[model samples]
Target: MQASLFSGLPDRRERSTAHKYLAFVYCTNKEWARCDAAFDAAFDARPSFALEEYELQNTPWRDAYVKAQGKRGWQCSRPLAGQGSNNRPGQDSANPLVFSLNSTIITAITPLLPAAGGHSMALDGGSPGAFGARRPMRTENNVQLRVSPWANVTLNGKRLGVTPPLTEIKLPPGSHTIDFSNPGFETVRKTLKVEPEQSITITHDFDAR
Candidate 1:
């Protein structure tokens, strides 16, 4: 669809519109590299592309891309207090500070969410069911969970959302038992210890009865 649009444009005006549209589509789809490339190409073709216009159209995307890149140390600036340096009141500088990428990203992006909070949690591993020795970490405030529709989700004792693909939800820090249920499938239960500046993932599969 995108390729078709890109190829269909004939005039400079049409081409410029196509580029902007493609950039927006990429951004909406969370294709950061493609979005940046599209915008870059547009600007290259039309140097007159206004920064304000670009920003208005791409600020959310740019912020997300910058943050995603920052996690991998792609384009991060040094903090005034310095990396892993804590300035807690009366705290000794000798104390070690742990630098958590998940915590930093969440803290940086949460403010961008609507009044309900725009924060979303990410599974560390590509596959949710793949579990390692380390358990998933939950954020202190407004923790978000994304799960597959095939996977059931329940908070406390009450059933929360449906299985397969689950909607994102905001949760406070503490202990929460998530029950995954599927008909003709074995139930999976996970106990999560939630804290601020932490991200965790839990994955399981149910067998058909």
Candidate 2:
């Protein structure tokens, strides 16, 4: 992942700075695991990094960051707009906004993580509901299939196999191109984005010639 390179820098300050932005990306996408990991990494890399300084330099981004982090149970160090400052005695008014802003910065960089492998794609649950839960089971990830009656499936320009009605294929998380066709049916081509541990299912109906 291009972002992983940011983790390799020898400068703790540089790494922490990059992590702040990356955390924001991950949090925005609701990838809590990755977001939390990035946040922890940032703090661990620079225990004394000044949150106030970070917020002062990146105010608006910080606000959004805080709001995002709040969703994940992190408290903002400063108060919201119109609220009085909460800084400790002798310390800077612990503008709660500082924490809030940093929180958001953590979530903003999740999608950039590299896909699982060359053959995988990312998938999401889409919407919440009973039906949403059913989708994953119905769709398999990265499996080859023949579309019932008589059709062949080609993935990444390579002839794979055929798929049955409502068949699910197991694939790695990332992006992929699928081509479906049969002798008389119109060929359908599609690009799919799959996420890790997510399943994908497709149904095809052929017309008689």
Candidate 3:
């Protein structure tokens, strides 16, 4: 719905800064063609903006723009001053026009974090009431668990699985107990809060018993 709606926004269509974000939305949807086009438009909007201008750049948009470029075999010029640092990227204040509480509608965009081995981490959830809670859902969110070595996993009291990496599991919103255990290592446990329509990550490294 958002992509379709944004597709009609004059700013997005006319190659405004919005094109940078539209590219992100497209990337999230894995719409490579649209993503590339949106990014290309962004570059055309500011072709001379150099990486050294990182300090003055809109970081999220710039980072996503560069990532898209790299993935597409397009070369990006790195800022000479800070060649190898993982220093934070530039930041931009959210536009008040687009992010006011009084507004009937709003959109929040989260960047995709690519993991090694060609996997990507992304979270997508619909409107608050879209996923009905008629009689109370069995689970309202997905949790991604990462544990060192393989360990037995459990939710509440039921065993779920043993995992070197547990991609995801569903659980009700609010608080829940997670348990992990592996031979020769101390058992690990945690209490977590799960928000509806969001992804939570839990990482545990067991200490040798």
Question: In TM-score terms, which candidate is top?
Answer: 3
User: Taking the candidates one at a time, how many backbone clashes does each contain?
Assistant: 12, 51, 0
lDDT of each: 0.43, 0.45, 0.46
lDDT of 3 by residue, 48-106 (tens): 42333432133333445565557556666655243222112252344211111121111
lDDT of 1 by residue, 49-101 (tens): 43232233213344433333344444433222222322223535443212122
Clash pairs, candidate 3, are none
State in Å the error of residue 109, model 3: 25
**RMSD (Å) per prediction:** 15.6, 18.7, 18.2
Model 2 misses residue 188 by how many Å? 1.0
Residue 124, model 3, lDDT: 31
Using alpha carbons, what is the TM-score of model 2?
0.31
Better of 1 and 2 by TM-score: 2
Candidate 2: stretches off by over 4 Å: 1-146, 164-168
TM values, all candidates:
0.31, 0.31, 0.32
